[model samples]
Target: MTTSVSEKVYRRGPFPVKFRCLEVLRVTPITPHVVRITLGGEDIQGFHSEGADDHVKVLFPEAGKQRPVIPTMGPTGPVLQPGEKKPDSRDYTPRRFDPVAGELDLDFVLHGSGPASSWAAQAKPGDMLGVGGPRGSLFVSNDFDWYLLAGDETAIPAIARRLEELPEGARAIVFIEVADASEEQKFSTRANMTLKWLHRDGAEAGSTDLLNQSIRTLDFPPGDYFAWVSGESLAMRPIRDYLLNERGTNKSWVRVTGYWKRGHADHVHDSKN
Candidate 1:
């Protein structure tokens, strides 16, 4: 999940992140609406993704182009070459990173007519995709009395990764909302976790109170807990406020992010904590 441009969340990384021009090794369908694109090559060397919630910007060149014109790390920042088409780009979670094999798996949700979704729908093996940053890793410690994780389909990659990385015998509570049962995913974790699946059925995404309502009804585990919440911007606002105002959760330990905002063409992540 991306932190709001305005908030200071926990993160660490080697600055001036490197860029990699990856090739699509294979494209496989993970679900009815989700696809896993496996990217690898010699360029993936030295790739480091230590946080479960790390995200990279995927650059898509114009149709029929072999690769996008990627920028270099300039003395100041990214130095874009002159007179070149800037390809479309979007942030996505790194589902799996195998440095030994030089492979990085990214999951994409195909729901909109946006460039990223459209590209994934038609992508094939040997296709070129540019990736940059992560710029860093949001490393939330697993050392807590318990953990609460909640979000929609966009947040699944991070949520699943966190569950898998938690120590054995640790306690976790998870809630995920999606289109229906078909969108629900199975997660394997050694942590003591209670997972709940909420279906929107026919309701429009980001136009309901399901997430907030669920959090209010559940009897949360006691003691020091780190809560991570992300999804539609409007839907996340109430939940964040409730946790801070009503629950009195510590500001430093809580992270609430809007992976995307409704009614906005570009999906920008924003957070209040």
Candidate 2:
């Protein structure tokens, strides 16, 4: 990757690790289920993200009101009791950023049930919300030589960002699993990327049927390559073993995150075990 003033990025590599209130400047529906929102605020000027297997938290306004009721302080952290009158929070990927112009774009999956998804479904102009990220990044150097990237829609933004930032001649295979063919979208990039969008006609987001089939059939060539996989936390188990035990992948080169679990909300992974 050559240096160019116009193509420079400040995000050290994903996780920025700070929270700020940003106002919604605009929202555009890219598809029937994918909505993109443009946010602006002075606080956004300092954000930087690597956008590879990374995500950010989006604090939403109350369901029935403009302002949320989450307390700045809590017994544990920033949480309230059940049935609390706090605004909902969702995780999303930074689709785009323009630090110089004080603008950041976040794309949302307008699925039902989830607070962030429902809010984005009905979100309108002049809405205000809190945005935070740059928590830090998971890095995989060109050391592997080749790479394999796979995940669900929640992983698409980061996957696309990585593709665009990869070295021009980098050899990589990317698989984005989606609900149906209609949900598919092209990811623009300069790297030699082979993007395969897999659609599970009636499958849910966290299911492993399609993801498992896809990973099991992959043809691993002879080379020191790496893999990055995320999505349903539970489903990643088999793939983790395949890469770590079967393929003999380097721990440093593979980043497999269980972004979400089947029965939990605001989920995360503590220890790799």
Candidate 3:
């Protein structure tokens, strides 16, 4: 029997959006510039995230505030309470979610002086943070013959999660770019993965063509493959174009995203083609 496209590509949920107030349970430094903050609380009871790239809006408290101001969930959507200021928030991938333990892990890359970076740098066990909505999930079937995963430091959390979730014997090729050799991360996965770490050495993030240049030289193995590429906005454009136009990758099987853009605060771009 021939496989149907819908059966191979699954999208689940427009889950009811829920905003939770979670407390930081621990802060672990993963690298010189990356920190992992694990959050847990009674509020984590109903959280759901199945997609490797699922995102949650992390609301940060304003200066002098003990906790972030959360919005009311209305029939239409999140409604701001009257006279209340909306807290500063940024979208972040859910690195790991353990429902049995009611814990969620988020990895933060320390760069510049952004709100998220600043909050993570000094975060401790007692810190309170507001988290809202994975909203939905897009589950790409792992039955593909092989996979291509590429990104920079910001994309590591999602890439790591995906790699770990792949079943035994699955084939995966990964390309990751980081600030330097010191910023590289190791992952534990059952899949047969060929992983490469690209170092910018001392170059500024988003200012180099390292990811695109590296991808250009890859000699892909023959198979039905799923490609996922994400990183700096401008840097990702050429890589996305290369995969779709030059390599003739199926549009529906490729996912490209811009986790952030240079000079722009809290920016995210997604192309599903």
Candidate 4:
């Protein structure tokens, strides 16, 4: 596979990456379609997730099972018990982690009947959720003249974190698409930011070009800019190509990803920056 901008930024880590099992502390709804699950355990003491776009693999147990088969990290890699079936897993952003509280917040998009989604829908306090490494962090410097952040609902957690982390006087232009007007959210940021929200209305998720179309109409600010985008894989391709080929975004400063793929059962959103 070719190296992407994110890979260059994160590289092979000298950073510590460990797998930890977190017990659910609370489950809250952020939106009609988004669930915020707060988890905590002693295992979170040294948890490290420093990037706005960092992700962890969340493991879910088989139906009727009481717990996920959490793996123990071995010298070679994650090691499972003999004859134990591997659990279903999906990638998710670490929305927030409070070391003092030993708590971590992960937001899940409840859009289907998939294991992760189904698990989140009925999650309750005391449930154990297995989470593994972000392995490394791609720390995008906030030193750019301006920034561009775009994505669909699935990308909201990352987008929200980035907006909140920008320093005072920084500039960020954001574009996000959600199901409808009710899905819009307000973000707190010290940066001079402009947010544009797109609505899919009645259109099927991952089947519309709202994000691409919105970005296309923007009169972007001049100067060196860092762009971070992700959503459905195919939906993001043209946008990534546009930034790299048409807008001349420096390959090193732009990051694009496919958070999910329409019609695909698995959600492994790899970067294509």
- Which one wins on lDDT? 3
| lDDT for position 18 in model 2 | 59
Clashes of each: 0, 8, 0, 0
For candidate 2, give the lDDT of residue 131: 69
**Local distance difference test, each candidate:** 0.85, 0.72, 0.88, 0.85
Tell me the tens digit of each residue's lDDT in model 3 across 109-213: 988678999899888998999999897776778889999999999899889999999999999999999988899889989999999999888899999898898
Error of 2 at 195 (Å): 1.8
C-alpha lDDT of candidate 4 relative to the true structure: 0.85
**lDDT tens string, model 1, 111-214?**
87888888899889998899997777776767788999999989999999999999998899999999999998889899999999999999988888988999
Best by TM-score: 3
> What's the CA error at residue 112 for candidate 4, in Å?
1.9
- Looking at candidate 2, the ten consecutive residues that score lowest on lDDT are 2-11
Ranking by lDDT: 3, 1, 4, 2
lDDT of 2 by residue, 1-273 (tens): 222212222224322255677778899987678999998867576777654645677788766776444434344446556776656676677888777787888888877778888778877777777765655555556534667889887777778777777887888888888888888878777778877888878877787466667877988767777677777888888888877888777665666877778778777643262
Query: Per-candidate TM vs. native?
Result: 0.93, 0.84, 0.96, 0.93
Error of 1 at 190 (Å): 0.5
| Global Cα lDDT for candidate 1 | 0.85
Residue 39 alpha-carbon offset, candidate 3, angstroms: 0.4
lDDT of 4 by residue, 73-97 (tens): 7888778999988888888999998
Task: Score candidate 3 by lDDT.
Answer: 0.88
